[model samples]
Target: MKSTPLACAFAALFFPVIASAEAEPSGVRTNTARLMTTDAAEVIDAPVLGLQRTAIPLFAGLAVDTSLYADALLAPNLGLRWALAAGPHRVVLGARYTHFVGASTYSGIVESEAPAIQSFEPELSGPSFYGVYGLVLGPIQLQGEARYGHYTTDYLSFTGGAGFNFAGHWSVVAEAGVRVEGGSAFRAAAGIRYGGEGLGFGLGAAYVDLSDPALPGESLPVLPVLDLSWTFR
Candidate 1:
C-alpha cells in the first residue's frame, strides 16, 4: 500500500499547529516544549480508529512525543517527535512509518473467473523533519511550519487564530490556515473549538484542491474533518 498522498498532505498541513497550540502555558520554555498531535484524517469517513499519543519531558527544554494509530483497512502508523524550544519558538523533528496490511485492486470490479489481477503495493512509509515557530501577540497566536520528507515531498503551512476566555471556565477557539505541499498540492481548513483549562474538543472542515497523480488532470473537492484531544499537566 503506497502511502496515500492525501494522508501525507494532512499530516504536513495540520499536525504542527495542533501540537503547538494545545500545549499548556507552563509547558512552554526555552529549549523545552511538549507537543502532541493526532493523525485523524483516516477517521473522517472510515471506521472509528483509535489514536494513542503521549509526551514525555526528558530534561531542560527537551521533550519527546509519540503516536500510534490503525485504520479500518488495518493500516498501522507510528510516529515520533522531538521538540526543543528557543525563547518563544519551538523546533520539531520527527519521523513516521506506515504499514499497509491489506490487499487492494486498482479497478473497482473483480471477477472470480479472471485469472490475472493487478495488486497494489503492500507498504508505504518514510521519514519527515519539520520546524515550527509560535508567537503570541496579545490574545492571538501565530504559527508556521515547513516540512520535507522522502520522495522529495515538501510542505509549508501557516496558521493564525485566537482563543477567548469567558465565564471563568469556558473558552472558545478558532483558527484558519493554508498548506502548500509538493509545489502542486494545496489545501485549506478552518475550525472552532470549545473547552476548559485541561480538556477540549473541536470540529473542523477542509477543502483540498490538488492534482491527483494516479488520475491525470483530476482534482478532489472539499472534505470534512473531526478531532478531539485532552491534556494532563
Candidate 2:
C-alpha cells in the first residue's frame, strides 16, 4: 500500500507522545494542536500530538523558530521556520526532517489458542518543505498551509482553517485538508479552546477518509484531539 503525503505528515505531527515542559518566552509564542489518523490498514492506531512553536526576533519584523516532536511509532522530528510579521498577518516558511524508527507489528490474525506475535521493521525517512500564512481580522483568525516532501515516497498536502473568538478566553476552530502521494486522503476537524496570555489547551474531534487507489477504503469516524502548551516571558 502507498502512503499519502498527508497521511505521513499527519503521522509525523500528531502520533508522537512528548513530555510536558515549560519554556521561558522572550519573544512571540505560538502553539498548535494537530490531529493524526493512522492508515486504515496500518499497524498502529491513530494518536494525537501537540506542537510547540517559539519565535525569537532576528530583526524588526523577522524571527526564527524551531519545532520538535516524537512518538513511539516514529523517530524524533525537528524543524526550523522563518517568520515575518505583517500589519495584521504573519507568513512562515519552514522545513522538517524525520527518520523512521522501527515499529512493532502484530499478526493480522491470531489463533484461538495462541498469542499474537509482534515484529518490527524500519521505514524510510526524508524531509519536507512547507509554507504557512495567518490572518487576523478582529475576532476571526484564518490560516492555511502547503507542504511537499519525500519520505520513502513523494507527497504534497494543503490545509486551511478558521477560528472565531467569541469570548475573552474561549474560541472555536475548524479545519479541513487533503494530501496526495501515491494516493490521496481527506481530513477534517472541529474543536473548542480556552486560554490566554501565552498558555492554552483545546479538545476536539477529527475525521479521516483513506479512500485512495493504493489503500483500502477505510474511514475513521471520530478521533479525539488534545492540545496543551505554555509559554514564559
Query: Which candidate number has the best lDDT?
Result: 2
> What TM-score would every model get versus the actual structure?
0.54, 0.62
TM-score of 2: 0.62
Candidate 1 is scored at a TM of 0.54
Error of 1 at 142 (Å): 0.8
Residue 213 alpha-carbon offset, candidate 2, angstroms: 9.4
25 Cα displacement, candidate 2 (Å): 22
lDDT string for model 1 (133-180, tens) is 556433334455555555334455544433433333333344445555
Predicted structure with the largest TM-score when compared to the true one: 2
Show where candidate 2 strays beyond 4 Å: 1-69, 104-124, 210-221
Q: What is the C-alpha RMSD of each candidate to the true structure, in Å?
A: 17.0, 18.2
For model 2, name the residue pairs that clash: 14-49, 16-71, 25-232
Question: Residue 177 of candidate 2: its Cα lDDT?
Answer: 84
